[model samples]
Target: MSTSLAAAPAATSRRRAPEPPKRTAAERWKRRGPLLPALLITILLTQLPLLGTLYYSLRSQNLLRPETNGFAGLSNYATVLGDEYFRAAVVNTLVLTASTVVLSMALGIAFAVLLDKKFLGRGVVRTLLITPFLVMPAAAALLWKHAMFNPLFGMLNWLLSVFGVDKIDWVSQFPMPSIVLMLTWQWTPFMMLIVLAGLQSQSTEILEAARVDGAGAWATFRRITLPHLRRFIELAILLGSIFVVQTFDPIFLITQGGPGQATTNLPFLIYQTTFRAFEVGEAAAAGVIVVVGTIVIATFALRVISSLFQEET
Candidate 1:
């Protein structure tokens, strides 16, 4: 019996499938040729500008004083790193990104769960929920600034008056939170769409089996649904953070980076440095930093998405 079992393993090893033959150079080129134009265009549009930014970041350049432009080594980077306002902007960026992502994710999960259920007017509800995301960022910011947060004639102050509470200048008094709220409203729909896809993709049969096995709704969600949605949640948070960190429109429209520098973030700071301060070198350095940070987040997000796809396959 032992001899037969050993022989069986050897036979199985011999019967393993052979690898496919490699493609010829010409065949490979044929497959890749169709993508070359798009690839070249993308490089021209993205990589060239990035290289230009890096080149400028290494030198001292001021738009207002063009004659003083010359190589300054890493002085620009040092200046940006040492600037207190840059540090403050970094903190604001982190806080804004974290707050917006977390609040939107929570609201998204709730909305997704509600919409996932079979209910009357479900389609209409989903459509309405998704409208906020479809609205342009600039338009949405303006809408919130004028129609919602305006102290004199805004909906929020009017609502407060109904309860005899004093009118509050929301954007003036709470610049960061007001920005967070606007971002959350716009991005919650994006999160909801992703989470809703995950929810809908869940195996109903497994859920039914859990129910038959005496699992309650909360128990079923905790044990199975939550685990299944983990990847989706991660994806939503990563993507949301990546986008929210670059928030400029809402801040520009709603508070103009606040009554002070209260709402200034990395992007806004970069804008101020380039346009207002005319410190091109420092702004380029800051832009490079932001790009590097975004690339890191994007890399992790791509990995998570890849793993999710692999699991599905």
Candidate 2:
């Protein structure tokens, strides 16, 4: 019986699958022709501007002093590094991004857990929760500024008044927190959607087995569900950080980077440098730095995602 089994395996191994024929150049071109226009357009839209920015960053160009435009080497970068406002902006950007991502992810996980359970009006509740994310950033900022955070007649102050608390100017007094709150509110729904998808994809059989083994809900979640959701959580953090790091609308609309430079982040600083200060070269250098930082983060996130996928497979 062992000899016959070994012979059968050897026979099967001998009958290997046939290799596919290689296509001619024309055939390959025919297949790829349709995608060429889109590829070209993408290069034109993305790569060209990046190259232009790099070129500008090496120059001493200022819109206000056009005649003085000349090659600056790395002076623009040096200027940006030496500027105290730039350092402050970098710190603010990190703080804002970290705070918003953490808050949003926590709330998202809570909401997703609640939504995952079968309950009446679940659909309606989920829809209402998602409304904040669906609203335009500009509109959301405006709504928070006028309808919620206003010291005089806003809903928050009105609620405070009922408890005999003084009306507080939230944006002016707490610019960073105010911006973080708005961002967290908007981004929580996004994180919830990702986590909810992860939860729904879990195996009912495994959950039932855990329950049968005398594991409680919290134990099952902590041991099984949480581990399963790790990838989803990482993905949510990555995407949330990418978006929140580029936050501009809320700061611009609500505080205009604050009563001072209190709320100025990298993106806002770049805007100020280019349009407000008219320092084209410095702005370009800053823009390049921001792009490089974002790319580094995205690359790391993608590696994590790839490793997770390999583990699952």
Candidate 3:
């Protein structure tokens, strides 16, 4: 009886002792332990500038006179919104964003489609196509502003003169268009590369089967390829729009926001306000507005992307 009781106690004790909780989860987590630190650091570094901008937007702290400081709440925002130059900047930015995105996507998709087909010098063509994206923005801007659009001294005017056309100052007559052209030249390759990646992701078998089913090229593209690349197209548009709206280098180097504020974008306005006019508070306000607008658009774009990813899965 004592032996049976002793055995019973031993068995119960063994059962009560928790099996060393499964080690795999803990081991896997330990392996991934660096992820949190990296994420936190990334977030901190990325958000610090924005946080500072937000802080300064609410206070009137002009560099020239720091003593007349006061918290103006949304007064700075009101001031920026009511400014004529600021309005022009916003309008120009929107125009640039729309035109560039549409043109880039159309041309990019066309270029990608052309490149997708096997042909002579296909590799060379791709290399050439991607070349513009690699050009230094400053150097390219300088070339466009001076070498190409210099009216009497410009290549564009020289070319126009060959056809008996009068020389017109590109900066004065077509400032926004000139900026758009330069930006599109720099940016279209980006859309092309992304769209091509999406194109490559389509299954060869599906395309073959479509061809076997008597589907024409247009039908295949519209019905099969376009549907498949919708996500990528959206991604390209979003990326291009983001860059176009905030484009600084070309505008700075070429237009300097001028010939009567025609091509001045919000970014330039912010630069002019803070740096040139030395209105720190107003610049911060512009910065906050820009950040908000960007965030809103980005959120919508990401939501679409997420939906597409879900559909793809």
Q: How close is every model to the real structure, measured as TM-score?
A: 0.92, 0.91, 0.86
In Å, residue 216's CA in model 2 sits off its true spot by 0.8
> Whole-model lDDT, candidate 2?
0.91
Which one wins by TM-score: 2 or 3?
A: 2
In model 1, which range of ten residues has the least summed lDDT?
Answer: 9-18
- What ordering of candidates by TM-score runs from best to worst? 1, 2, 3
TM-score of 3: 0.86
Please, what are the lDDT tens digits per residue for candidate 3 over residues 74-141? 88999989989888888999998998888878899999999999999999999999998899989999
lDDT of every model, 2 decimals = 0.91, 0.91, 0.87
Deviation from native of the Cα of residue 218 in model 3, angstroms: 1.5
Candidate 1: tens digits of C-alpha lDDT, residues 59-104: 9999999998999899999999999999999999999999999999
State the TM-score for model 1.
0.92
lDDT of 1: 0.91
Which candidate number has the best lDDT?
A: 2
- Model 3, 39: alpha-carbon shift in Å? 3.4
